[model samples]
Target chain A: MKIQVLFGTESGNAEIAAEDLAESIRNDNQEVEVHDLSSFSIAELQHDSLYVFLCSTYGEGELPNTALPFYADLSVVRPDLSGVRYAMFGLGDTFYKDTYGQGATKLDDKLTELGAQRTGEIGRYDASSWEPVGEGAVVWFAGVLEGVSATR
Target chain B: MDAPLSIAVIGSGPSGCYIAQSLRKALPQSEITIYDRLASPFGLVRYGVAADHQSTKSIQAQFSRLFERENVRFAGNIEVGRDISLAQLRSTHHIVVLAAGLSADRAMEVPGEGLPEVYRAGRLTRLFNAHPLEPTGVPTFGKSVAIIGGGNVSIDVLRLLIKQPEDFANSDIDDAMLAEYGQAPVSRVDLICRSTIANAPSDPVMLAELGRIRGVRFSCSDPIEVAEDAPRTALARAKAIGELLEVDPGPETRAEVVLHFGWAPVSINGDGHVRDVELRSVNDDRTNQRLGADSVVTAIGFDFDGGDWHGLGALKADSETGVLDQGLYRTGWIKRGSRGTIAENRSCAKTVADEIIADLDSLEQQSKPGYAGLPEEVRALAVDYAAWKRVDCAEKEAASEARTRRKFPSHEQMVAIAHNKLVESSAAQRGN
Candidate 1:
């Protein structure tokens, strides 16, 4: 399966996670492409392939600076992701008073709203606990693969 | 081997958290302790971000998870210079990450900067964030408010002054701050930009947000000259111009807050108090404008406040590259002047981290110690891992009870809570 990994990071953590995930997938003989969400256009979401979004929510549940324009575009109009299978891993803190992980949750909801099938349970990683890195991420990805395989 | 190298990270802000997380991922065996002058982690994320923008603040939850790592510890409410010294840190931790951010605002260089009403946007932001220094009383907005500068800071201040609770209630602003903001008689917020709209650093999101304001009108005209005698008129001219010129100042627009672009402040006209601000056109074309407002906020920018390490020869920074004398590492606003969004800081930080890692192999061969050995002063203040976690929990509980996000009103509160929690946990462990 051709897997495309897209990530948005404010301080590079999400990018690092995305890269690590892509590397792990590649090691398993799966073709993986990783792109920064800032560089990735909304149109690319329509590609006929499996997708994984590893995005970091920034100031006040907003998208990272690089992913803002794309987010803005998505917010206004829904894009078709009919056959695309996807999973979202959002990096955020729940400590903030407002809606915590609101940004990532918004994206996940929007993607699903546009008819994309969620391949796995949405992974919401809290940096406060540091439990979501390494093995945690690996296990989440494994579950996604299993789901995708079953669906196929 | 050898009890995994101990690393202490100072500041616990975004940069500090990122560094700690990266180090943990790179070397899981190493022990990491994140420290901050405040009792809570995530420095600016807790305070600097505007209250209405709760979405941005949500990122702090991610940092909290990083602290929960097996080998990572969070220490809050411990001032590095005061509680501990740089020399002390070197004795304990193998590596010390100084992610301390800029603590001071860049001066406007105008005479009336010391006036009561003239505030720094950074300071104002901290106040609204309920930072330790936030004044107790409502700020006197008078009839007009002139905010100098065209950056994100300026935009935020303008938003706060104009939008009121009806605009911000849905956002994450704290109750106390929102109540105070709602009571303030801030009819107009004039955003002063030294350059054209194209050159201004104000975010487009802010501009779009500003456009939505009902009672506030944004003007982009040259400020009127302030005469020695007619101090009030000079300030009122922008308002007057806004009322007459704006064909459609939007539906909620009433009080004119003229946004003056292309003017550099020359002086503040007053001896003891701020009465008027004398401004000159940037071209030195002799065109003058005097802005009369009760309060003036210089939102120019922020600058790094190098702590006790300022005069240390060991921390000497190269004039050109901004690298430290040891050359093992460098950093964000301190290394490359304050500018750029968080996204930009990522690339800069990555470059610095990469350079430090690249030299690690060569330095190990030469028997030179990496940043593992911090100065003694920093190590002294390092709180135990469990203590920091308690402080983090206390802040969360406090924020939740207040129906607001996490906020530690004072540094002392954080320290006390953390210390108590440490004691409680120790007692429980002993009983077990």
Candidate 2:
């Protein structure tokens, strides 16, 4: 299966997480490519690859600088994503309380509204927590990968 | 076409890496080599950043890419002054950037500071991060601990000391050291701050995070007063502290963190180790108090010894710009003192890079050997990126199931792992 690791970041944390996920996928002898969400056009949703979105929340739970363009593109274009499957991992600080992980939640909601199928739970990491966002995301995605294989 | 010059950047920290990045973009064909005393790169990001804040440390992934470029290289385990003189590097490279960060801890300058249980925040941070130079042993902070500072670093030390084992899941913290620290549970932590609640330097987010920790009580010496006309930052900070003070730890509370505003450390008093800290009010009231503490950690700041490191009696660089001699330059903490975040270092490096380009571009410059000009023994001692990757992998592979990675705390162990040498045992490698 072709896996696309899409990332949106403010401080490059999401990008690094996406790269780490891609590296892990490759280690498992799977084909994967990583891309910045800012550079990914909404039209590319027509592709049959499984998408894994790793995004971070910026100020007041808003989408990160890089993810904003992609989110806007998806909202306006509203491409048919009936056949698209995705998984989400969000980076946020619980210190923000009200808006924590809202960026990823908004993106996830948008995808589902567009008839896209999401596999596994939407993983969330709190910056205030002791665990690293990347480490937690990797652990969560491992379960998602297992589920994908089982469904296959 | 841009001038193809030889550039050597000392210290592979954020400033050095950013300097290399900016220089690479300006002069694509130029040779760039970043040098560090440790076997690994990402100086402070790897050693000074809190282990739990791996997201912040992930900036290293971007820096690692710079080393993969043919034009830029990393020379680890090489000190410019000790291994090869600054004069030799200047003779070899067109421009030499000194990004060697301030490593020395600024002394508290109070009596009884030389006690055994008193540790500098930098030293403790390094120990927890598993910096190769730090001694291989877990610190014992006993039941009561006193931290001197109101900065984010003081909060980081407090968090490290108080976090439970389960809280450390998936973190790359020194698990063995953490386990040892956990042996003697810290019941109380006093944060002695010279600034009031409104003026405290710690970030509001950090203060709020402390409120969320389970089984901990938080209190402030001075009540937070949020003024309607105050600055937005001050208001936010006051709100965060107010919220922290509202946290009800209840009877189940295992620990308490007290914030003492407008208090300056007069002395750290003890017979042999840290037994108590004496503090005097910074206000005109001039009241003094003695708080009993088993351990005292100071998170004040860091300093650089310009006299010993740089060959010049004192580095006579331009205060605004980092220009010293014609070919010699400086950046990061060495240039601007111990201030600015990692992001600020990026801009500082860019400014220095711009100056270097403008200075060397118009002039007819002679070619010089950059990395090739370093001593053969020094080059041999240096660990390349590939070898460093082996050490990185080994660290991860050796980690327990719950941890992301377990760092080798000694230079010998890291060097052995990097070189694929057969070390008898971890204990033997650490000479314990």
Which of the CAPRI classes, incorrect, acceptable, medium or high, describes model 2? Answer: incorrect
In candidate 1, what are the lDDT values of residues A62-142, reduced to their tens digit?
676666777777767777768877888887765442435666787888888888887788877665453535345667899
- For residues A46-73, write the lDDT of model 2, one tens digit per residue: 4579899998886546787677888888
> Model 1: how many Å of interface RMSD?
9.6
Score every model by TM-score. Answer: 0.70, 0.75
Per-candidate Cα lDDT values, in order, are 0.66, 0.82
Off by over 4 Å in 2: A1-152, B1-3, B69-71, B315-318, B362-364, B424-432
Best prediction by lDDT? 2
Error of 1 at A4 (Å): 5.8
Model 1, docking class: incorrect
lDDT per residue (tens digit) for residues B294-327 in model 2: 9999988788655556656655323589777797
What stretches of model 1 exceed 4 Å from their correct place?
A1-152, B1-4, B133-138, B170-174, B177-182, B222-254, B284-286, B306-310, B313-322, B362-402, B421-432
